[model samples]
Target: MTVAKLAAAPRTAVAPEPTGPVLSCAGLVKRFAQRTAVDGIGFQVDAGEIYGLLGPNGAGKTTTIKMVCGLLDADAGVVTIGGRPLAELSVRALVGYVPQDIALYPDLTARENLAFLGRLYGLRAGLLDERIAEALELTGLSDRDKDRVEAYSGGMKRRLNIAAGLLHHPKLLVLDEPTVGVDPQSRHAILERVQALGDSGMAVVYTTHYMEEADRVCDRVGIIDRGRLIAEGTKRQLVSRLGEKDRIDLVASGDLQALAASMRGVTGVESAAAAADRVHVVAADGRSVLPDLVEAAERSGATLTSVEVSEADLESVFLNLTGTALRE
Candidate 1:
């Protein structure tokens, strides 16, 4: 779908000259007493781009976001929104934030909630009403604007939450796990809305642990872990980091650990690990490496029942880099 047809406004404003990145963060660090939350992270989000921060729980994604929004002070590092430091309140006014948890009043109607938030952003009178209507229509909630938030379905509530964020026409939108706990239909709608926002020239920083969501929605992704960025690239680029390593899954009966060790020493094998009934092997090339894998298994007294060779994917890349599965 075209962005102009989806968004309520034009993609960007006409500038006297091309400016620097829409958003830039460098050496961003956040600490809570003795524990470090965000560890010197850095990245940039250009206009009309959707940058995803992906990691498991407690990877400091939320903490990094909080610091960027000025909801929390950074122990060190710098955050700039539209070339201005985040310490500048004016820059904060230009950002739209959607938190992980629902922040609206449950007893209020969707329209009421949007009006309240719009007023907080200094919108008023006819202009505020017009913006609220535009947001409701954009999020497919125009017909349900008078429904109380608590009476709305999970998906509807999420859509309204997003609409509230857009009411002030912020230049940058930061979404923190916006699709969590929603049904598949709701997730799809949310993603479509996010893509529309990005296409309309609003820079976005999306955080989620869902690999599939990140792969589908983000223009580029930064994979953070334990407060450190371990990988950053497009989905294809990140998967390509596994370079020449084809993954093979073998299910067999025998000493799995011993078989895994033997497979690791194979000529073309790069790494191997055993988990329960399955043995995972990464090889230079699966086609040629299969024969050697079988031989290695036989030598280890494994009665191989099945073997499968799959091309390297993001999951495998995550496993290889972190020594743990992304979903774990």
Candidate 2:
């Protein structure tokens, strides 16, 4: 993938010596009036790593992140950064939080917005200006620095929001669905920027409902479901949990339901579901079952346009653990 052509800037402020993990959470829990939003969850992120939190909407991912950022207090457990507990105000400085929603002033110019936020972090004078410039260049918005935010495209706004988070040169950046509502190009740019951030030595905690994003960027993934952490590991480690199972996705044009049903009894097939013009089939051996699957589709009057087979992925791992599809 081509990285954005960002202007060269000073190296990200060197972080403290890595005496330990960059971010750590242990038995973190949260509760609302009657809902246990996050329950006894724990994980750690090391410097220069991108840790992905994957879950469906309201699976406690947001709540856990809020607690990690100290925006919400956890009812139980502990969150720490660089060996310091989150309760310490000094720790907040080591963390930069990019919320799910746009947090910039739409009426202000991009430069002004970043400058204002930097000032809040005690940045001033030449140092502040340098930080703002670096952030704009990093997000590929330096040319639009003088443009009012309200006049920018959705992708630009999202990129600017991310730039705001880096103005402080944080050690652990927390991004909550930073690409939720944007064009495909914008999402790709954001993901590329995030990967670059990790490559540059900053730890990042990225949360998203998008499975492909997690697969592409995360060094490690934690799957959360119904307020519980179901699994946590690298993609290879998680997929290994699927054992010998294979995942087959077939894009068909007609009678998907009947096609799904037809494939359920295919030799070696374990389960099948059809929705959104695709059929997802799990089998003992995808290669061995491909012919049967194609024959089943043909017998059921479904026209297959595309087919993909893999041993397992983050999506299949999620489904295996939660008993539901990742997007559902």
**lDDT (C-alpha, whole model) for all candidates:** 0.83, 0.87
- lDDT per residue, candidate 2, 66-113, as tens digits? 999999999999998899888988678788899999999999999999
Using TM-score as the measure, which candidate wins? Answer: 2
Clashing pairs in 2: none
Deviating ranges (above 4 Å) for candidate 2? 1-18, 252-267, 271-275, 287-307
lDDT (tens digit, per residue) of candidate 1 on 129-207: 8888888888888898898999999988888888888887777799999998899999998999899889888889999
State the weakest 10-residue window (summed lDDT) of model 2: 1-10
The TM-scores of all predictions, comma-separated, are 0.84, 0.87
